[model samples]
Target: MSWNPAQYLRFADARLRPALDLLARIGGDTQPRRIVDLGCGTGNVTRLLLERWPAAAIVGVDSDAAMLACAGSTPSAIGWQLADIASWRAGFSPDLLFSNAALHWLPDHDRLLPELVGQLSPDGILAVQMPANFAEPAHRILRQLAGESPWRDALGAVRMGSILPPADYEQLLRPLCHRLDLWETTYWQVLSGADPIIEWMKGTTLVPFLQRLDDSAAGHFLAAYRERLAAVHPAGPDGTTLFPFKRLFFVARR
Candidate 1:
């Protein structure tokens, strides 16, 4: 199953806020002839790029058909393809490689980033944003809780990848590109209702956990998760839950 965009309302149009910030810093008059979104999940990022560069030919690629289906609904002008970046090829060298909340799934971006840059035109740009809250209490406690569950035997080996250390990312991409911008920020998301936290995660971190189990185990997982979350994520003074989320933003122009 692909990620359901409806489940990730927190990252819906709200994604544009951060996406614009990243793009603005990497601003230029070099209009791209082509653009590609590496893991175009549901095309929110893809659509944003299109809105910014309507003249550019844009393509969104993902490994999941379900995700591509949702992306296809945006417009016939945007090309959505089902393919893995590891082996995927760009029909034409893109002037900009844009990715959001994607790329941590990639194992060796340090080595891979240069290769992707090589796919760019003489002077292309690469902009990416990824959630980097693996160290946060929310993800930490959830993983620990899952490890203790009976179903851990099957899912225990799954380890989420890091979105590169801030320095490591700069070190890897700075030399290859003419300009590089890298930083991280925490968005204090005020979610209404005691249960919105679960809804927020279903579109992301909770996905793998739930996919590991059958219907029964998945229900148990969510129930246990909610119980743990309810204890840690106490309601704020406004009677809403505040999930302080963090993400890393990086842009390198070659």
Candidate 2:
């Protein structure tokens, strides 16, 4: 799916909170010599890594050229690589492998997570955070709309792949990790707009559905989705919408 950096950043502060939370939990004794930010969209979170470990050599890896282009230049010390996160390998075993809001795009964490763990140094750290808000109305509305008429035919298998429960992640990583910190947080974000929920999903969840439809059909889908969302997540007295977004976070040190 194509990503629009501008659209994704519409709620930048809200989207960035989980990344900051994930970074805060990654602790170790030795200073990292090398770090990699997998699926570093627009280098926003990657820039935080540079700030935290200015001495370390950091690389930002992403698949989209447009998003990478928006990332622009970094210091000579930081490397920007264009590659798929699923198959991308670091030239050196990194001291820290960080991915924020990226891994969920790929399915099958059962196999994928272990492959990433193997790429780490013996004592390396793997830090990740991803949206676990699939059950929320914003996403539920999309699934409901996708099941209807033209959308159903055009957007086959529109639902997200299975995202394992929180306990499942702990079970999967416990054997491989010496130290593991896993938790979930629900952020009550207050957004202001005509249809804030729809605006928010347009950046991420709505992209795939929109991609399959032409302009007219896409508009119809959005209208139907908006009506459904407004009923579920109506604006408050102050004209702000409270969007409860849940996210999963984990940090494993091998």
Candidate 3:
């Protein structure tokens, strides 16, 4: 699916919070020499990696050329490469492999997690964060709408759900690392604007459905989706909507 960098960055501060949280937990005695930002969308979080490890050779790997173009060049030494994270391999084992809100797009974590861990150096750290809010109304409504008439035929067999439970990720990565830190955070984000939830999903979850439909059909889908969301998440007295977003995070030190 194509990505809109502007749409994705609409809530940049909120999105960057979890990346910062993941980075902070990767504390160790030694600083990394080489770092890889897997699926680094627009290099926002990749820039944070640069800040943390100024001397490290940082490479931001993403499949989308649009996002890569938005990432552009950084003042610090950083390489932006267009590559799919599922099959991406660093020329040398990286000291830190960081992925934020990207792994959910790929499937088969049982095999994928181990492969990623194997690419790390002896004392390397793999830090990742993924949205665990699939069960929330924001996501469930998307699946509900997709299963309806017209849309069902248009978006045939498109899998919208991909994230695994926290326990599942722990079981997948525990044996591969010497030390592991796993946790979940639910951010009750107060968003302001008209249909903020819909706007939020447009950048991420809604991309697939919207991409499959034509302009007219996409508008219809959004209209229905907006009605459903507005009912569930009505604006408060202050005219702001509260969106409780949950995310799963892990840090594995090999």
Candidate 4:
């Protein structure tokens, strides 16, 4: 699916907090010579990687050409590559493999996660963060709406891949790494504007479903989705909506 960099960066601060949190926990003593930011959209988090490790050679890999263009447009030493994160391989072993809010879209993490860990250089670190809020109303409603008439044929098969549970991830990665850290955090994001949740999903969760429909059908689907979301997440007297988003983070050292 095509990505809108502007839409995705609309909630930049909120989207970035987890990434910053993950970066802080990545062992301050680390002095990696090479780093890879997998699924680095628009190089937002990739920039952070550079800031933390100025001497490290950093490459940001993403499948979307548009996003890579936006990232590259910004003058920096960081190299931007257009490649699928799921099948991406480093020409040389990277000291750090960092991915923020990516990798959930790929299937078969059982094999994928271990392979990623193996790709890291000896004593390398693999730090990742992924959204684990699939059961939330935002996604549940999207799935529910897509199954109804007019949209079923177009979207019935549309699937939003999700991450494994905390226990499952521990079981999958502990054996591959000498050190592993896994945790979850629920960010009760305070958002403003009418139908903020819908706006939020438009950047990520809504992209696939919206892409499957024509403009007219997509409009209707969005309208229905907006109505349902408002009922569940009404704006408070302060005119801000609270969206509790849960995310999973892991830091593994090989």
Per-model lDDT:
0.79, 0.87, 0.89, 0.92
Q: Show model 1 residue runs off by greater than 4 Å.
A: 9-11
Could you report the Cα RMSD, in angstroms, for every candidate shown? 1.8, 1.4, 1.1, 0.8
Clashing pairs for model 2 are none
Task: Work out the TM-score per prediction.
Answer: 0.92, 0.96, 0.97, 0.98
Put down candidate 4 lDDT per residue, 1-254, tens digits, no spaces: 89999999999999999999999999878999999999999998999999999999999999999898889888998999989877888989999999999899888899898889889999999999999999999889889988888789999999786988999999999899999999999999999987799899998988898898889988899999988888888899999999999999999999
How many pairs collide in each candidate, listed in order?
Answer: 0, 0, 0, 0
Better of 2 and 4 by TM-score: 4
* Candidate 2 structure quality by residue, lDDT tens digits, 1-254: 78899999999999999999998887645578899999898888999999889999999999988788878654455688999987887868998999998898888799999989988999899999989998887877778778878778987687553467999999999999999999999999999987888888888888888988999988888898888888988899999999999999999988
lDDT agreement of model 3 with the native: 0.89
RMSD of 3: 1.1
* Model 2 misplaced regions, further than 4 Å: 28-30, 73-76, 159-162
Worst 10 residues of 3 by lDDT: 69-78
Compute the lDDT for candidate 1.
Answer: 0.79
Tell me the tens digit of each residue's lDDT in model 3 across 1-254. 89999999999999899998898888746699999999998998999888877889999999999999999844557899999998988979999999999999899988888999999999898999999999988888889889998799987677765788888888888889989999999999999988888888888988888899889999998999999988888999999999999999999988
- Residue 88 in model 3: lDDT: 87
Global fold similarity of model 1 (TM-score): 0.92
Report the alpha-carbon TM-score of model 3 versus the true structure.
0.97
Error (Å) of candidate 2 at residue 231 is: 1.0
